[model samples]
Each structure stands twice: as C-alpha cells, then as structure tokens.
Target chain A: MPTAVTPSVLTRPDDEPTAAALIAAAVETMAVHGYHGTSVRDVAAAAGTSPAVLYHHFESKQRLLVTLLDRGLDVLIAATEEALDLAGDDPAERLGAVVGAHVGVHLESQRESLIGQSEIRSLEPAGRALVVTKRDVQQRTFERVVRDGVRRTVFTTATPDDTARFVSAACTSVAGWYRPGGPLDGPTVIARYRAIALDAVGYRP
Target chain B: MPTAVTPSVLTRPDDEPTAAALIAAAVETMAVHGYHGTSVRDVAAAAGTSPAVLYHHFESKQRLLVTLLDRGLDVLIAATEEALDLAGDDPAERLGAVVGAHVGVHLESQRESLIGQSEIRSLEPAGRALVVTKRDVQQRTFERVVRDGVRRTVFTTATPDDTARFVSAACTSVAGWYRPGGPLDGPTVIARYRAIALDAVGYRP
Candidate 1:
C-alpha cells in the first residue's frame, strides 16, 4: 500500500466562483439543516446572491444537491482508484489501500460525505439513481477485491460480499463521528481502518 | 449466547390512538422525506388529523422528531441490555448478543432507525443533548464489552475502543442497505453480523 496516499482534492474550475459559492453554501446549510430543511433561498442568502442567480446556475434545489453529491462521489471515487492503482497485486495490500482511501475521503470531506449519506432519499428518482450508480461502482470495487482475496485463499471470510459491505459501512461511518482536530489524525485513522478491514476479512498475512 | 435471542420490540400503549397515529405517520413521512423535508401538515394528513391535533400531541415538528428519536433509542438500548443480560459472562457471547440485537432492531425498525440516524442534527440543543446522552450509553456498552474481552485475552485487537466503534458502526449501518424481502432475511443478516463482529475483534475462541 502507498504510504503517502492523500484523498483526492475537491476543486472546481477558476471561472465558476458564483456556482462554487452556492455549492459551498448548500453544503454548509444542508449539513446543519438537512436537505429538506435547507431551501434554495437559504442557500442563495448564504451565497450572497439572489434566488434568480441560484436558479440560473441550477434548475432547482434538488439539482444543486445533485451537483454537490456528484462532486463528492467524484472525489471519493478518484481517491479509491488512485489508492488501488498504487497498491500492487496483493489482495491484502489492495484491500488496505482502498479502505485507507475510503476513510481518508470521508475524513477530509465530512460535511459533503455526511450529506451524501443522509440526503440520498431527498433526491428525485433519477438523481437518486445517478448517485446510487456511482456508489455501486465504489461498492463493486470492494466486492471484487474481497472476492479475489477469497478465491486466492488469502481472505478466509465465509461471506465475501457481507464482509465487503461491513468494511465499507464501518469506514463510511467515520464521517459521522470524526472531528477535524479530534484525537485520531488522518493517517492514523487511515492506518487503523486498514487494520480493521484486514482483520474483518480474516487476512492470512 | 441465548439460542432464542430476539430484538426488543418497539410497541406503544394502545390507549393513545391519536398520538400513536401521529408518531407512526411522522416515522413514515420522515423515513421518506427526512426530518426537515417532512412537515406537520403532511404527518397530520397521513394520520387523518389536522395540524392542530399534531400540535396538541407533539407541540411542534421538532418535538415530534425528538419523541420519535427518543423512542427509537429506547428500543435499541433495551434490546442491547436484554441481550447482554442473557449473554452470560463470556465476552464473545456478550459481543455477539449485542450485535445481534442491534442488527435485529435496525432491521425490524428500519424507518425509525433511518430517521433517528439522519435527524439527530435536526434536533435543538436540549433534545440533541438528551439523544446524545442515550447514544453514548449504547456506545459505552460496546466499548466496555470489547475492553473486557481484551483484558480476558479472548479478543486480540490492539485498539479495543476503535474496534468497538467500528463494530457498532458496521452493525448500525445494516439499516441503510437491508431490505425485508431482499436476498437475505433478518436472522441471516443478524447471524452474519455476529460473525463479522467476532472476526473484527480477532476472537481467539
């Protein structure tokens, strides 16, 4: 596993300041008030813009949320992919890398990650489907690695699918309780989670 | 561990039909639209009552949510306590029983569980404090069990607190993906989670 792996940074093009501001405001408001609790007006007010300007950028409040959720998933997916690429051929190393990256992303993007976890129900069916599809891609990455490990006799878990799900859920939940300056630092969290994932899978080495 | 272990059931007194209806409606609506997305009017309509009646019962939407969240936590805490009581003195049995009961409650009380997980942030400070206090009790239950297991040398985890947190988070998260009529049934899910939790702690026996 890579020693210096960092979460993929969430950045936008330099030209979209107003849009960026609106997204930032939405993250802040939604983090506090939730999706149904937050309004386009609230996001606009927080962004120092009018509802008309908010509408010009995104068709509706749900659309703005969809945009933000998509971006958050993008960062998570990118980070996981980068970690896996650097993890080499051993299934244990790959599992550690992916779990590390998963924890890293959720820690670095707590609000966005929390929103993504909580507000998927708030989206329209189409938007929900879009986010679920991205989420499934990430899920499949873990599933495939675990299945491979089992096939190779490296992971002794009786239920590969369930083990993968448990590891992902355990890692995903870090966002709910993790504080930025909390006792555990980023690399420490990443490393501990990697150990937990390995143990959960009954890793041989 | 008790062979006939089951999750504690969440039941309300049959006397308060209107209040019960209101609470039930709130659970359903909040499950779909979330705490902030749900409104008193919607819950009232669903319960076949008026906003005044909802107010008479719950005082406000937040109050209704706080009530719901409190009830959910009560059921969870009761289940865990009962499981611990019946689990004998073995730390592995204790861990299995609690994880089993936790998964059982979340599966049977999916809507309430989902709402409780997502809506804690929607509570006022006093209500949030009350709920957090209850939540901490449940968390400490797991922490103490794992710590004891470590002391007894039945669990080989280097970090008992983190392992406990990971196990609880992993079990709590089953509510997010589990479906009643899905591929796995409740007992199967519970059994799988017990094994996963045991493996997570590196159980020696």
Candidate 2:
C-alpha cells in the first residue's frame, strides 16, 4: 500500500500558538479544498499566522492532522461511553442516549469529526495507523452497544454487524453535506437522527 | 461551479461496441480513480480499445464524464419510476417495494450510481444540470412517499423532508462499502433494507 512518510524538524521555539488553533485552521481548509488540494501555506494563511509559527507547533502538516484526529477521536469515544454510562442498566433508555450521543459528536465537533473520518489517509503511515486504531476502538465500542442491546432484549436488529456498519456510515457521513443552511438545525437534526437510528436498531422511540 | 461540458456528438456513427459500453467503461474507471485522477487513456484501455476510438465517441474526458452522468441519472430515474408505478396506491407497500427496487439499483448498477453521486460535480454546466434534475426527481419521489405516509398516519416525525434526506443518505452511501461478498446476498440486503427503511419512515413493519 502507498503511504506518506513523516519528517520531523523545527527550528523555532516553544512560544507558538496552541496546536488546537493550527488543527482547527487545517480542518476548515482541508474540508473545503480536500487534503491534497490544500497546502501548509494555505493553512497558515487561513490561520492568520506564519509558517514558522505553524512549523514550531506541528513540525509538518501530517503531524497537525494526527493531532486533530487524536483529539476528535478522543472526544467521540468519551462521549459515547458517557452516554452509555449515564443511561444506567436500562437497555431502551441506554439505546436512545447512545444514539443521541453519536449524533451529538458529529454536531458538536463537526470539523474534527469529519476530517478524522474522511481525511486521515492523507496522514503519514504512523499517523494513519494512529487514526485507524482510534477508529477501530470506536467501532468496537459501537459493537458493544449492539451486543448489549441485543442481550437486554431491547433492540433486535436483523443482523447486528450490518446494522452497526450501516448506522456508523450514516452518522459519519453527516459532515459531508451538513451546513448552516439546511432545513434542520443542530438539535433538530440530532433529534431526527436519534429517532431514525433508534428505529433502525429496533428500538421503539 | 466548474462543470464538464456536454460533447457535441450524442454517440458515434460507425461504432461496433455502442455508446452504452463506452459509458460503462468510463464510469468504471472514474469510480476507481475519481474524476480528476482518471484519464481518457485509462478508460479506453479498460474498454479494450484505443484513444482514437474514444475520441470518436467522446470529445474529451470532461465530455465523456458528462455523458456518463447523464446516462446514470436516466437509469436511476427510470428504474425508480418503474418501481413506483408497479406499487399501485398503497403507500406502505409501495414504499417497501421502492426500497427493494432502490437496493436492486445499487446491486445492479452500483458503479454508475457511485460515480454519479460522488463525481457528478466534475461534469460541465449542462451535464451537471442533467444530473441534478434526475436527483431532484428522485428526492421528490421520496418526498411523495413520506407525504403519503404522514397523511395516512404512518410516520410520526415532524419533518418528512429531513427524514427522507437522512434515509436516502444512509442507503446511498452503502454503495461505498457494500461488496458482492455475501454472508448477505443482494436479495437479503434488499429485504433487510426494506424492513429497516419502512420502520425508519414510520411504517409499522
């Protein structure tokens, strides 16, 4: 498989802007123009900073992406776990909360969520493996939800694995066409998605 | 919106293979390597022909894409319409049949469907409009299903439009990951999707 290789070097010191800002800028630019279509210079320009400052923090573009993907996946995994935890031992209520949290992750962390899912392959081999690991972790967590739901007899999907993959694909692809101009706003879209997801997973909302 | 222009010629005059074969080859190549990544040489090679033969059929790579977009949209619209017509006046049953037919379209013509949805923007002005028209038609037909469902007290969502959009996005993106690999065959996937979609749209299946 063809993979990008990472390089590490920076002449600047530790007073640079936070990695968060750089990753945010990279997210917007990468989302609009795609990963390859954007450059380090464009990211700097969009961030309203110099390449020297950017280099001081990230070392390279792929490193910046790695930072973003890690942060986003961290947020995603935590939110799903939190939702499941908060719902207690009840399968039906727990199922709805998990769906809400899944949709909420996309809405709250739209940019990071999108870039992590779609643009991670643009990262170098090491960075890509890191992102994939995080993704697999989340997928397994989702699988656990399905297994739990089935065990509790609250959700009875025809095929647990296929249902899980279908729901994950829909949830992840939200950032592709989602924007401010849509007919539904954040909470409304989340509610709608939660309802549909719950139903598809065989929960009665 | 940069778009590929329509070719001056509809098809070819002394072509033994026919325009349909040429369109299929172009779509296959485009799906494998997005619009910008594919070349006329790659498409011609796939078709078991030469560049001169391609030029006779398509004015340029852009024009060839436009033709494929036009043809893909036509096929989907025709298939869905035929499915609708076959279902008669029962909304829930009609919608189930529609879902089955929708999956059939994906299984039978996944390559064109994939390219048309993911790479249609590569088509020129007129060609883009043609694709959009067909898509809008599909969307409208879906809306009709939702409307009928709501009118008959079948669906409970506040907005049919968002529900339709979410369901459409969910099923269509299946093209990205769905393989001919079957622990679930075409009929099984279609059957599951029909049940899933009907419940999703508020049908009590």
Top DockQ hit = 1
What lDDT, from 0 to 1, does candidate 1 have?
Answer: 0.87
lDDT, candidate 2, B1-205, per-residue tens:
0022122122344445535456656766666555665677887777667778788878788888877777665666677888888887777777776666666776777666666665554566787787788778877877888778888887765667766766666667666556887467888887777777766676653
Which regions of candidate 2 are displaced past 4 Å?
A1-25, A36-72, A108-133, B1-25, B39-60, B120-130, B155-158
Q: What is the DockQ of each candidate?
A: 0.71, 0.31
- For candidate 1, lDDT tens digit of each residue in A34-116? 98888889988887888999999998998988988888898889999999999999999999989999999899888889899
Any idea how many clashes model 2 has? 4
TM-score of 2: 0.75
lDDT of 2 by residue, A19-122 (tens): 44466577777655546556788877777677887898789877877777777877778888898888877666665676677777787666556556555545
lDDT of 2 at B28: 64
Best by lDDT: 1
Residue A64, candidate 2: how far off, in angstroms? Answer: 6.3
**Every model's TM-score:** 0.94, 0.75
Residue pairs with colliding backbones in model 1 are none
Q: How far in Å is the alpha carbon of A116 misplaced in model 1?
A: 0.3
Model 2 local distance difference test score: 0.68
